[model samples]
Target chain A: MSDPAAVPPLLDARNIACQRGGRMIFAGVTLTIGAGQSLLVRGPNGAGKSSLLRVLGGLIPCLHGTIDRHAPIALADEHLALDPDNRLEQALAFWARMDGVDRERLDFALHHFRLRELADIPVRMLSTGQRKRAILARTMASGARLWLLDEPGNGLDAASLRGLGDAMAAHLAAGGGIIAASHFDLSHQFGTVVELDRR
Target chain B: MTRWFLPLVRRDLRLAWQGGGLWMPVVFLLLVASLYPFAVGPDARLLAATGGGMLWIAALLAALLPVERLIAPDRDSGIFDQLLMRGISDEMIALVKLIAHWLGFGPPLMLALLPAAALLKLDGAAIMRLELGLLIGTPALAALGVLTASLVAGLRGAGALAGLLILPLAVPILIFGAGSLHPGSGAALKFLSAISLLLVAITPIAAGAALRAGRE
Candidate 1:
């Protein structure tokens, strides 16, 4: 237990196959991500990148095979999933409360994501880039061990991207792992890369 | 580990209030009840006789007013996916939503009944029976509406389909509730309550399964 290197994978998927609206998007996918490690999922559009993440997050059933998740998961997808009518802090607070997060983590996440200044603004009032940042802030404060990031880098500015990188680094340093589906180059290195080729 | 259900319920209530969901049904019920006296030409005896049934019909239709918005908006917005990721099951979500929906319209509908009864010239006894029937029957109405909303949340023609789906399931409550006012049918209230209890119990499971099936 003393050596983090001795830790086993926090997430292990064995031969996962999933279908979306009667099409088998991906098949025979296997991947393992351990504590303090990250997996990069790369594929062209319509290559089942989002589907694979959904399967991993248990939003949809796996058409075949199995998934073993040793810890809780936080997923950030194309949808910011925040109520547009609510203020930025209120919208995030709804999710934070659901995740059983406290005020301190919420403040920390807002600071790290550079959203503290915009906290009082309505979500619908934010720019697309800022809204995405709000979503990332929710994900960071979720206290989940596995982060499933779907196109996390989309709409992020260079500075915000670097901040995301630092957040990922800190998360990994604390024994959490990330599985991200992204077309953009990630600032943090990954221990494993999974390419889901278009069929 | 998720305490989000209460927040979810509170948010839904707040949204419903702001969105006019809370008042739409009440006004709709009032309009339907008020128009009935003119249709029957204001014969006090006949109006009292038929007004109770008219009120029941208005309640049923009013229960349906918000079905189109109940669960579809959240599902379409991918909020359900976020909830599932947090280890909260769809069953719990459906249950919370059902409660929120009932709170949104049920009491308001009961309060609307007072004005509706007066417009129909319902006698004192008829008014008492009507109010009690609504108290027992509105929960069943809410359950059916929520259940139908979950069933057709994402499908084409969902609004019409929900109306079609709910009417048949709701027939038992309708019959028993309206029958409670009839002569020599004191037992109708008990049957109405029994049906309401059954629907309330089944909603969480039925709606939860529908949501899971939708993910396919």
Candidate 2:
């Protein structure tokens, strides 16, 4: 268990609303995630699952409400969030540098994610699962307190899924938090589940 | 820090270099210039007089072609959103991208212009002037191109929109780039320099603001 008195809530979203293409996608969505807590958002396609993630990640504006972050946040949208033309190592290095992660941690992350051999390969050549592993490598390497992941499990195999679970557990154990939106059955691992109704 | 800037630049440059074969704009620029003599009836003087303008236009078009791809790949792959989440300011990302574009397209296009200049029968002084003007002016064009690129990065039909948005803003550079090869070369050169410097100073702010707006 985390010391709630010592660690603040990683994210606080109040009354958040999102509209896309002149239509209300979701409204009045509110949630809070604290250290050692993991929240999963489940909904049908186009239920604004990705929109909510974007809002929480600060990639898009929420039509209403405030999202406050207690620490740096890392988001992995449906997009791999990497430069496809760049080599895996180079791409992750750039992310690590941007997130202020030290070189040692980055190396450890690459090894942990089983990407050490393919580090020099351009991302375009990597398979979907490899690419997702690279993206996951970046998120874990980022060392951020709040993680906003959209469809994080899309390309993972069983082993990689276990790795993802392990990463989440480690992050939460270290006073980090996760807010992931997925269609998969992640309820057994996550601490809380928020279901969004179709708009 | 300066250290961060160098690595970013180096990595981007390497990627751009490896992907050099994918540059269709350079091929298009050469092909268009090669066709000009045939289209204009082999009039050396006329070609010489018009060559700088033609090359500048071609360079602008070619430079603009890749701007969308520059940011789109990052945006599509989710690296862009991650960058923002990591707390690197939008301005830095924009500036780094602009630098990468300049290094990737600007110098090679300038080199390719020599062959185009020869085919157009450009005199020595005119070639010197064209090269110098493009050297300074292209960076400014690239800077503005990046600004427009960031704005329309994820928008539909962004290629045409990029042309529309940047061409109007690039008028000053085009005017001076072409004018610098004429009789008023000295004055035009100064104007080009001033514009380049001004753009260098202001482009980051515009790109930074646009990036922030897009993120929001």
Q: Using lDDT as the measure, which candidate wins? A: 1
Q: Write the per-residue lDDT of candidate 2 for residues A22-78, one digit (tens) a residue.
A: 799889888999888999999998788888988888777888889888888888765
Model 1 TM-score on a 0 to 1 scale: 0.96
lDDT for model 1, please: 0.89
Clashing pairs in 2: A80-B77, A81-B77, A81-B78, A81-B79, A82-B77, A82-B79
Write candidate 2's Cα lDDT for B1-216 as tens digits.
664677767767776767672365668678879998998879888988888799888888887777776766665656566666766577888889888888888888888888888888988888888889989898988788788888887789988899899889899998988888886568888999999988877777888788777652
TM-score on alpha carbons, each prediction = 0.96, 0.85
What residue pairs are clashing in model 1? none
Clashes of 1: 0
Could you give the CAPRI-style class of model 1? medium
Chain A TM-score of model 2 comes to 0.93
Interface RMSD after interface superposition, each candidate? 1.5, 2.7
* Tens digits of lDDT, candidate 1, B105-129: 9999889889889988887888888
- DockQ metric for all predictions: 0.75, 0.55
